[model samples]
Target: MSKTRCLLLAVMAYDRYVAICDPLRYSLVMNRGFCVRLVVGSWMAAVPIQVGQTYQVFTLPFCASHHLHHFFCDVPPLLELACADTFWSRVTLHAVILLFAVLPFSMIVISYVRIIRTVLKMHSAPGRHKAFSTCSSHLTVLTLFYGSATAVYFKHCSRDLADTDKYLALSYTVLTPMFNPVIYSMRNREVRIALRKLLWGK
Candidate 1:
């Protein structure tokens, strides 16, 4: 459920970036149908990624002594739990990173760079500030979400994971979601105004 929703949201943001920020086809691209198609594509891609993760968990040689160092049984945590010789497992892990994580991360980076450039290209001070504010919130959430995951892969996993790794995983999975709306919405006057209007029915 979370994976589907997150994938959908990620696609939506990418579509929005293409529609709003692209230099050539900003106006011509991402019609409603295209948006739908993009989101559907994300769902299609995510299903296999999630399934591969599930298959890896059940198939891997996690002995009784092997413990999952995450709140949920994600790919990295399951890999950490393997008790057998992991020579091939590490190779597969990097491949998985390139497939699911690295590719999506590259897409996100491309989208945001285009967005920040678009914002900065604006001339008027207020308009540029507003754009910066809006994109800053989004960038904040992206950094926190991706940064924590990167930490686990680069810092924790590179060093060998332990039960303490779960806290870092929780930061990526749980805390980031809670922080996203606050970081992205609470600082925006228009969003706050809309929320107040919805709340008071005025």
Candidate 2:
């Protein structure tokens, strides 16, 4: 799921970049075959790492007491159970998060910066408004998703994950997905039209 989402987000950032920055070449750049390959590549890249990470955690010997403080069974919470040395595990975890989260996030930021610059240079007010509206929903989703995940996993100490962090995790897992469609509906004319047609046969 994490791998799929990261890949999707990366593709989305590129889609928006092409759409906003090089509208003339958007179709040529983002054709159907290109998109399919991106999806397949994301799965291939993310699966091996996720499998390896899962195996590493489950193989660790836990102490006599078995309890998890967090709401879910992710890497950080599971590591708290390790009876063995955890320095390398923690380092690997951080590196994975940096690769999946920080790197994609940096690409998104760079794309948006170029997008904003391009939008501002547009001569037509309506064109600029349309461009901003198109990117706003994606930007909001990116912020909510990354902001919560970063707060949860990137902490200096995994043992410090409080109940509040659990709520934040909930927001990351639950609220982000829930609000994605809502944000799109509000900001996206095509989505609203499609929803209306589906619901009311309009």
Candidate 3:
């Protein structure tokens, strides 16, 4: 699920890139068939890699306590439970992170860089604002999702910081997703104005 989301987000960034950088070609470039292929391709790419990782983790002889420290069967927590030498497991985890998280994130960054350049070149102030506004929600969601994920996955996990990991995991897995709808919905001008009025009586 996480891997799929990352890839999907990358696809969205590409869609936005095409829309902003080459609006004339947007319809043709992001056609219905092409969109379907992108979605399907993301799933196809993520599933096999995830399955292989799951298989590798479960195959490890967990000689220690069967209880997981974290809320779910995450790779880091599962690795902690394994009594065997987890050199390869750790390697696989890093490999998966590089492929799913880092690579997709890099693609998003590149898309946004070009988007920023294109937006800056716009002569009309409203046009610039509209272009930046179009990306604000996506950028916000990306920051929240990737920030917590990076904090948890990229760090060296230790028993002393297990609680910290749980909180970070909760942010990415629960809180970030929970806020996604609200965040995206606020992209609408009416929604934003209403929200401001409700909060500040403006």
TM-scores for the candidates: 0.74, 0.88, 0.93
Better of 1 and 2 by TM-score: 2
Candidate with the greatest lDDT versus the true structure: 3
Give the better candidate number (2 or 3) by TM-score: 3
- Report the C-alpha lDDT of model 2 over 1-202, residue by residue, as the tens digit: 2656766787798899999899999899999999889888877888888998998898789985687776778787777778899888988888888888778778878888899999999999999999988888888888888888878776666445577677888888889999988987777678788888999995
Question: Model 1, 1-202: lDDT tens per residue?
Answer: 2355445446645765764476378556767777777777767876776676677667777676665445777666666567766667667777766666666667777777787788778888897776566556666766777677777776634435555566777887889888777776788789899988999977
Which candidate number maximizes TM-score?
A: 3
Query: How much lDDT does each candidate structure score?
Result: 0.67, 0.83, 0.90
RMSD of each: 4.4, 3.3, 1.7
Question: Which residue pairs overlap in candidate 2's backbone?
Answer: none
Question: How does model 1 fare in lDDT?
Answer: 0.67
Q: What ranges in model 3 sit over 4 Å off?
A: 193-202
**Clash pairs for candidate 1:** none
Candidate ordering by lDDT (highest first): 3, 2, 1
Alpha-carbon lDDT of model 3: 0.90
